[model samples]
Target: MSRVGKKPIALPGGVKLQIGEELQVEGPKGKLLVPIPKGITIENKNGTVEVTRESDKYAALHGLTRALASNAIVGVSSGWTRELDIVGIGYRCDVKGNLATFTLGYSHSIEFLLPQGVDMTVDKQTHIVLKSHDRQLVGQVAAKMRALRPPDPYKNKGVRYTGEVLRKKVGKSGAGGKGK
Candidate 1:
């Protein structure tokens, strides 16, 4: 038995689930659909959900199915959040409705459009908080923002996740090498 699959998921109040070819979880916040793979079965018993596999051949699916279901349950119930920070002298962010404009020391500002089910908020012009019911979508949006201006290894100037660790590369030293 898979360790994760063996554990059951407790459905909170106001949260409903439908198990079929896919699992549909609906709650106060929103709804999430999680696909059920082959050889895996999910059952809702006593307000808790359990995942089981037909045989050892479905070992991987057992854990994966459980995890996805768990995420979906939490997502619909509460939601997920991703935080990012802008690091630089002139790098800042502004949000107007569903659009975010960034000034990352570039000649022209960059505009990012927020996708459906995703909401962004800016604080102190340097902190960004993204909220969404879909965990995967929140991560993807954060990744795209980071890719816009990845942190500079030398100066560490760009957009990065909060508490993200970066190693700064040392600059070239004065001419002190073995020279004739």
Candidate 2:
């Protein structure tokens, strides 16, 4: 038996879910849908959502489906949030409307056009907060932003996830010596 598949997910307030070929969740934030795979069944009763598989043959998929479905439900209710921090001297981020402009120690500033269903907030010029009802979309957008200025191993400077720990590498000392 899959432990995660057997666990019941509770729906929070203002959230409504419907189970069909796929699971549809709607709330104040937004709506999310999770496709139901073969040998999997979902039930919504008493404000709790449950997922079950026909047999152990789908143990892996069963747990994965449950996790995905639960995330969808929670996403519509409380929603999902991702944070990113830009590191570097003079590095700043400004968001207006759906476009975010970044100045990350580059010759030219970079602008990112946010797709639908994702919103962001910039704090203190370097900290960024992203919100969305779809977990996967939110994560993908954050990844793309991080890729723009990925963390450098030596300097450990660049965009990084909130509270992310990185291993810093020391630079070699300058020594000018000629061999005979």
Worst 10 residues of 2 by lDDT: 171-180
Off by over 4 Å in 1: 176-180
**Clashes in model 2: which pairs?**
none
lDDT digits (tens) for residues 1-180 of candidate 1: 799989999998999998889999999889999999989999999999999999999999999999999999999999999999999998999999999999998899999999999999999999999999899999999999999999999999999999999999998899978998
> Cα lDDT for residue 10, model 1?
91
Give candidate 2 regions above 4 Å deviation.
Answer: 174-178
> Which pairs in model 1 have colliding backbones?
none
